[model samples]
Target chain A: MKQLTVELGERSYPIYVGEGLLNDIAATLGKHRIGTKSPLLLVTDEQVAKHYLERVKGLLEAGGYKVATAVVASGEKSKSLSVLEDIITVALEAGLDRNSAVLALGGGVVGDLAGFVAASYMRGVRFVQIPTTILAHDSSVGGKVAVNHRLAKNVIGAFHQPEFVLYDIATLKSLPDREVRAGLSELVKEGFILDREFVEWCDANAEKLLALDSAALEHALYIGCGVKAKVVSEDEKEGGLRAILNLGHTIGHALEAVAGYGELLHGEAIAIGMVGAARLSAKLGNPASIASETERILRQFGLPVRIPRHLDTDAIMGAMMHDKKFTEGSMVFIIPKDIGEVEINRSVSSVWVREVVDSLKEGE
Target chain B: MKQLTVELGERSYPIYVGEGLLNDIAATLGKHRIGTKSPLLLVTDEQVAKHYLERVKGLLEAGGYKVATAVVASGEKSKSLSVLEDIITVALEAGLDRNSAVLALGGGVVGDLAGFVAASYMRGVRFVQIPTTILAHDSSVGGKVAVNHRLAKNVIGAFHQPEFVLYDIATLKSLPDREVRAGLSELVKEGFILDREFVEWCDANAEKLLALDSAALEHALYIGCGVKAKVVSEDEKEGGLRAILNLGHTIGHALEAVAGYGELLHGEAIAIGMVGAARLSAKLGNPASIASETERILRQFGLPVRIPRHLDTDAIMGAMMHDKKFTEGSMVFIIPKDIGEVEINRSVSSVWVREVVDSLKEGE
Candidate 1:
């Protein structure tokens, strides 16, 4: 097992990366003094609950913890105010208190939804993340928990960090091919924003990683979580350095909102968004080769490189205008300077945004 | 003007107590660097909007702000999750961004609802409190923002402190007689739990305070807010010291939940809860004089001293058992030791609870 600690002073927690760690949840959580006597709420979605709920519950119950389960419908729709209200009601009905801890056991949707549930339950409670998918490697570690509104994604949320994140590579075996590719998009994002050599490593090991080989997946996730952990520790509230993590997210979130959440997976939209950002960077005088490289890498991962033909460019622009990241009326975009470098620019012209988005339209 | 600061380190903010400060909204907000160019969302209720919305908007606009308004329906129902969703959607439609500020321009409901909105919008933003009711003297300063769930009051919430709290006694002139008495209940609670002298003062000047005399109300709010500010500064998240501040809240919240929210105003329910706590404290070996004194003071302020006959004891106990403060199935109660001292007792027997609650029932 490899462990990395996200140093956030009193809020610091560890991320455990290894194969078969799910079975050892009790022991790992115990190391952090999360005892069997503590009331535990195990939140998962239908899909993940079907596959691993009992197994995980049994392990904790065997360790003397009384586990109460709340299984939400699986998908982005679960990240809504109404769904959050239901989770709170369920948690209260289960007799969970401020001393109780919530264990989120699923993909990013479950993690985000459950994390917010824990965040607002009694003004905040300790929660652990047992991520079931690769995409959650990003969401679970950063502690950016939220529920979506009808008009926007993550419009209502908080920056509540988890007690710890426990990642078991064995769970990756159950994910579908599309899910695996979605997870890699974030791992690739970590590399693109911080470590150049890490991107190169992912490019070389794509096949082994895609196969869900324990060793390759563990190494990729460890590196990905490490970059994220470091960034979050430095800027927990995104006052400055943390905004870099939103490199493709500005356009990416706009895409998700325009496409209607769940229609386009977060990672898939971000894959296309990263491409859009790269094109904008190239137009703004970054080397053309870097933009091509981003496109090439996304395509290699089976991720989309262009905006979907059905999406309206004008609608996408309108969506971008409402993004929470926008301050006043001006929009900020994270432009890639090169494969391993990026710059935050608020000076991107709308003419350039329109031009690049127009260029990606169908039959152009 | 009288001012008290809630010292929360980097989250510290001031509570300004006076008459006619609402007219000075622009100057005060500007002092905090909430500039004219910053986007502003003025949230109020239908009733408050009818009287103060345009006035507040005009003041902010005159100070250079581009203001937008979201008027929610008046009453506790506005604190529902659906109402929260509607507010967020309206704020987004109004083009609020990360740099924008939400000014809650009414009583406790608007403060709690809008504070949560600012807390969750874009992960958090600066919000100012323009509390127009006396009850807000308690709610606005502490930053305990939340929207209620169907099953529980403040069951879903966060402790997001505001930038500043501006209390203008002038607005209290328009409140109904019942609302004025309701606000005083919290003020008396502050005195009962923390300052015996303040309670005596409230007793001496009950008529003036009840009449909403500027001098009396300002003094009462200042002292009330000072005690609250001190307690909150000592314990921000209710880890220990803060629970004392919930002196009347455990049972009070239960009352609200059982009464179906709007049926009982928050302070009125708490007035009864404080009496119950005093009775419980006396039964637990405190002097009988304390209980009598509590009943006397509540009666002096036109506050209810007993649970309504129609309220089912079993239902209220059921709600209390689910309070967020419970730990390991043991309920903790803030029992008043004397006029100005309280003890947190976790060993109160359920049998004793039943007896005390039954004693408060009519025809007993």
Candidate 2:
């Protein structure tokens, strides 16, 4: 097992990466002082619950922890205020308290939704992340937990870090191909924003990593988490350095909002967004080769490289106008200068954005 | 103007207690770096907006700020999840951004609902509390912001402190007689749990304070905020010292929930709850004089000293069972030993709670 700690002072927690760590879940929780008598709520989605809920429940119960389950629908829709209310109500009904702990067991949706649940439950409680999909490697780590407002995604949320993140690679075997690709988009994002050699490493081992090669997957996730952990530890509130993590997210979030959430997965939209951002960088005199490289790498991973034909440029721009990144009518975009280098451009003109977005039409 | 600072390290802010601070609202906001260009949203209720919204907006506009208004209904109903969603949508529609600030311009309902709105918008934003009610003196200080859930009051919330708290005593001049009395209940509570001298002072000047004596009111608010500020500074997240601040809140919240929020004013319910807690303390071997003196002072302030006859004891007990203070099957209660001293009893029996609650009936 390989372990990395996100050093956040009192909020610091460990991320455990290995195959078959689920069996050790009880001992891991015990080490964190979560005893058998603690009121425990395990939040998951229908899909994840079907495959692994009983196994986790048996392990916890065997270790004498009385666990309650809150299974939400398995999609982005669960990241809504109504769904958040449901989880809170269920948690209350289960008799969870400030001293109680929540264990989120699923992909990013479950992690984000459940994390926010724990964050706001009686002004915050301890939560553990048992991420099943690769995408959760990003969502579960930073503690940027939130539910989507109808106006925009993650506009309503809080920065409450978790107790620990326990990732068992064996669970990845159950994820669909699309889900695996979605999770890798974030890994590629981590590499693009901070580590040049890491991007090269991802490109070299893309297939092996895609094939669920345990060693290759483990190395990618570890590097991805390490990059994010370092950035987050430096800027937990995104006052400065952490904004870079939103490299593709400015345009990416707009895409998700315009596409009417769940229609386009977060990672898929971000894949296209990263391409658009790179194109904008090239238009601003970065280098066309960098844009092409980003497109090529994303395509190799079976991710979209162009804006969907059905999406309207005007509508996407309208959505971006409401993004949290915009301040007093000016938008901030994270532009990739090269494969592993990025810069925050706060003065991106609407006309330039329109030109680049309009130019990304299929077959344009 | 007399000012008290809630010392929360980097999150510390001032509580300005005086008459007519609202006239200088712009200058006060400017001192906090909220200038003309800051994206500002003023959240108020219909009642407050009818009297003060335009004044505040005009003042801000004169100061070069582009201000937006979101007016919720003037009651506890506004502190619901749906209302919270409405506020977030309004904030987005108004083009408020990460750097934008929200100014809550009413009583506790507005302060709490708007504070939570600021706390969750883009993870969090700075919000100023311009409390217009006497009850707000307590809510504005502690930074315990939240909306009510259907199952309970304040079941879903966060401890997001304000940038500054501006209390203009002049606003209290417009409050109804009942509202004035309701606000005083919290002031009396501050005395019962922490300062016996303050209680005596309140008892001596109850009539003058109720008649809107500016000097007496300012003195009362300053003392109330000072007591709470000291307590909150010692325990920001209620790990230990802060629970004492919830002295009457355990059963007080239950009373509010059972009465169907807004049916019984918060201070009125807490006035009764404090009496019940005093009774419980006496039953658990404290001096009975403590209970009688508490009842006498509460009566002097025109606050209810017994549970409303209409509220069901069982329903109230059921509500208490789900309070955030409960852990597993056990409940924690703040029991008063004397006028100014209290202790947290973590092993309070439900049967004993039932006996005390049942005995508090007006007819009994």
Report the number of the highest-lDDT candidate: 2
Per model, state how many residue pairs clash. Answer: 1, 0
What lDDT tens digits, residue by residue, belong to model 1 across residues B1-364?
9998999999899999888888888889889888766578899999999889988899888888888888999998898788888888878898888878899999999999999999998788889999998888888988899887777778788998899999888999999998899899999999888899999999999999998889999899999999999999999988788888888887888888898887788999998888888888988999989989998988998988788899999999998887777788787899999998888998888888788888877676
TM-score of chain B of 1: 0.98
List candidate 2 segments past 4 Å from native: none
Model 2 agreement with the true structure over A23-133: per-residue lDDT tens digits: 999999999998776678999999999999999999998888888899999998889889889888888888887778889999998988888888888889889999999
Assess the local accuracy of residue A313 in candidate 2 as a C-alpha lDDT between 0 and 100.
Answer: 90
Question: How big an interface RMSD has model 1?
Answer: 1.1
TM-score of each: 0.98, 0.98
Scanning candidate 2 chain B in windows of ten residues, the lowest lDDT window is B32-41
For candidate 1, write residues A1-364 as lDDT tens digits: 9999999998999998998888889887788787766579999999998899999999999988888888999999999888888888778887787778899999999999999999888788889999999999999987899999878888889988988899988888999999899889988999999899999999999988888888899899999999999999998988878888887887789888888887888899888788888999998988889889998988889988777788988999998888887776666898899997888888788789888888776576
Compared with the true structure, what per-residue lDDT tens digits does model 2 show for residues B1-364? 9999999999999999999899998898899987666579899999999999998999888888888889999999898888999988888988888878999999999999999999998899889999999999999998999998888778788989999999999999999999899899998889888899999899999999989999999999999999999999999988998888887888889988988887789999888888888989988999999989998988988888788888898999999987888876787899999998899998988888998898888888
